[model samples]
Target: MPHGKPGQAGSFTLGPASGDVNTAYRYRLTSGSFDSGWSAYKPGATATIAPVPPTSGTMVLFAEAKDNYAAGAANSVEFVVKEGDGPVARWNFAETSGAALDTSTTDQSLRDNAALAGGAVRTDRGRRGEVTVTRATETTPAVKSTDSGLKLNGTTDYAVTSGPVIDTRASYTVAAWVRMDVPTRNATVFGQKGVNRSPFYLGYEHTSKKWSFREVNTDAAVGTPFSYQRVESKRPAVPMVWTHLAGVFDAVNNTISLYVNGELQGTTPFTTAWAATGPLQIGRVHWSSVYSDYFPGVIDEAAVWQEALTDTQVAEESELIDAHAVPSVELVTAWTPAGAQGTTLRDTVSGYGSDLALSSGASLADDELVLNGTTGAGTTAGPVVDDSGSFTVTTQAVVDAAKILSKPDGYKAQILGQRTATGSSWSLWFEKTGTRQEPELDENGDRIVDENGNPRTTPVPVGRWHFGRLTADGTGASVESMEEALMDTETRLTGVYNARHRTIQLYLTSDQQASDGIAYTAQVGTGELAVGKGYLGSWANFLPGRLSDIRLWAGALSDSKQVSDVVGT
Candidate 1:
């Protein structure tokens, strides 16, 4: 008898011919031969094995053969398990030629069928597999100004129905892009009212040529007022040009920062405490139940962030917006030489000389003068000089004579002199008597004469000198001169004269009335008056020269030191 192994899934034959000796064969899926179990089939019979389910690990297959003989008589036959006769093992394509096999026959067959149908087999390898998906919420879409709000004929304006509210208790940064088809004239861009009924807002006025930030407090019956700050950019407001505007409010820090075209223009502090209000209004503000200061421009992409943006981020945003719009002005300019002196001191002839002399360290090439500290001891040379106490010029000849003053034209005169028995002590002097003074032509044009017809004469002290000063305090010309002496009996001089001349001049007694003996000629030099006055301030001399770097304030200097420091002689 012959026996076959189970589950081998292949045919086996075990029969002997009539002339051949009797033989038997057996086959089995032995543990060593077919560890992964197999099914057997009869000779000339077809059998199929179902596809194995996908498994993670490994698979193996084997088959065995044996010879059997009857009990009464011994029988033998050679038997063998051929390679194709055993169960077929599977493996991956990558491992098929190596240690493992492709056990997924169904997949392999499907790929083969696809290829036969003229389709390529695609293995989605190295791709991100199966990801969880999410859907976005519907945001309130913002309309571009160019699309909706910008098409109006002139001064088109719009308000946002829904936007983030600014909280006074917290800090915030607001930014926007704007292009005015017509000038804004004077209007507000953004604003909010505080709980204290105060109005704080940012606005631009074309007529005034200013961009202003106003914080108005309505606390007192008369409304106690204060100016937190205001700033104006150098560029003029131009039509059809986009400008970037930004404002940052840090209530806790009490600071307000303003930015134009991504650059910080100004910063100030909030003097009064901030009061709470809901949302800030954009494009308009209500004052006394009227919508005033309406913005007239195309405002697009307005944003309000809780945090202040860094300078780099602001610049990046500016660049991004500029790419889409034309800027109103050139961002930078090449260096060029100026035509005349950069600054002019108006009153160069006044005895109260500001240190407007040029310093050695200064240069026309760079157009800069270094002030403050320099090596020279007395009145270091510069374009400006401050004065201390009073300045005076005594001799009527110095005033009445033709003194070619070195000063900017169109300046006024101030003369300080005195008339007394012990030599005129000190008295304020001005151009009292002179013809052709209105259209003051030159240094030689001024003269002093007595209306008393006493032959304008010099007082008793011929050698005494008085003080006078010409000042250009960033305004029109002014002359200040005075002479004071506590002991002398004051003489009321009948005639005094001054001139607004371009060149400072020295005079001789011959230039005065023949009766006066006082000599007007420069004591130290031929054409220069020694600028020194004892007990008054530093004494020095200034000849006719260029004067520059002049400043004048409406109010007097804040401190005595400031005046002394500026006019250190």
Candidate 2:
């Protein structure tokens, strides 16, 4: 849009999209009824509307691409005519020096007064912003800003707003880009402090293991059971990824909604709402006469609005992270050069000081470790393996059938695992020649009879590959793929624990797909991660093979191409 002085006739150009894409445009007053129906989509075409943008109040310019398919999410820019500018307060954390400035409004009172405590430091790794509010008070059009965010160190790190930003008793909306590093406990993205319980909170709820929006019905420190009402997302929150969360309190509708990414996840009806007054705490919650649930992650573009943002408004904000952007990933460790640091296998990822100590019983050659079924193994030497909820482990190895040491039932060979005295956090191994119990069948599929008239039975051979995992709640299960292609061949095996889906996937070589992954979750055990062997009770299930490479990622590598690339087709 071309802008001149506010009073001059307004002239806006709907230019052809880049890459010669076809685009359409429309405009309407956010609070008024002047609507320009979507213009015809055409490449290199221009469209003009007789009505100019509102000289006051608010106007929205909506644009959508019309190529072979929708190129991206519809983008709408809000141009508002306001006194001080747009949001009540905005913390971009983009400052190179001095306190981070609040750029949305000019009111000195509403400026950035949040204090960074503990290890909360400004970081350049933040979301790719896609929306920015343009106010008529500005001399130029608004441009989206992609800037740094505050990294909260989970234990004591946080940003405390000097004072409350919005009236919690009334309808309001609050949002931020949150990248959770871990979900060991309930974590807060933003929480309004009060005498006791905060009036509203948006973050991961420990009970449900889901992103949640919490609102209390009373302002008093002591409240009835009905005072606490929360709406949790249908999907569990996956750690080590950046996500946009918006908590909307609609006093008019008597409902509270939580939006994940950009879409409304779930809404809960409330009987009443109360105001919480005090400083707004980012990355921590105060309640029960003590501060707790300090967030272990990063927060960016934290803002508050006095009004309940409509669905369109929320969707527009969701666009901050492009609809097509590849999901963000946090690499916890990558143990490369398997034998890089002399006798110890050094983790090549900088800042992550994980090294694997190959047992003296094992021999390293050509960056590969050869483990005998009885005497060889390698274990994580540093403080690794604490990523409990979601993780991926990929390895390339060849299992020698002879080393299976097949007992009467079968043999087990551990490829990777983190096990402690109490239970196994996760384990992947090959259960070779195990038998499946079933009724014996005669030629016609009928159960065969035994001498005493009891049904005859036979043991059926179960396939080799199996993955085992335990949830934080103590439940555990192991799933085996019945493909029967025993572990004798060199293959890439990728095990993924996606806490979001509550499932575990074992991916074999790219040429084939293991049916569906067995469902599983993660629990961090006290033991360090070990390759070639995992403990069941007495450090058993040793692998006798060449383990060429093994790498662990914090996020799930579920995408087909992602698996193929990481594991090699």
lDDT of 1: 0.32
Who wins the TM-score comparison?
Answer: 2
Please list the C-alpha lDDT of all candidates, in the order they appear: 0.32, 0.67
Candidate 1: tens digits of C-alpha lDDT, residues 122-182: 1111011111122223764322211111211223333432222455445556665554445
lDDT of 2 by residue, 111-168 (tens): 7567787778987555532223332244776454444678888899888877787778
Name the lDDT value of residue 249 in candidate 1.
67
TM-score versus the correct structure, for each prediction: 0.29, 0.53
lDDT of 1 at 492: 21
Shift of residue 510 alpha carbon in model 1, Å: 80
* Model 1: residue 524 alpha-carbon error in angstroms: 52
> Which 10 consecutive residues of model 1 have the lowest summed lDDT?
112-121
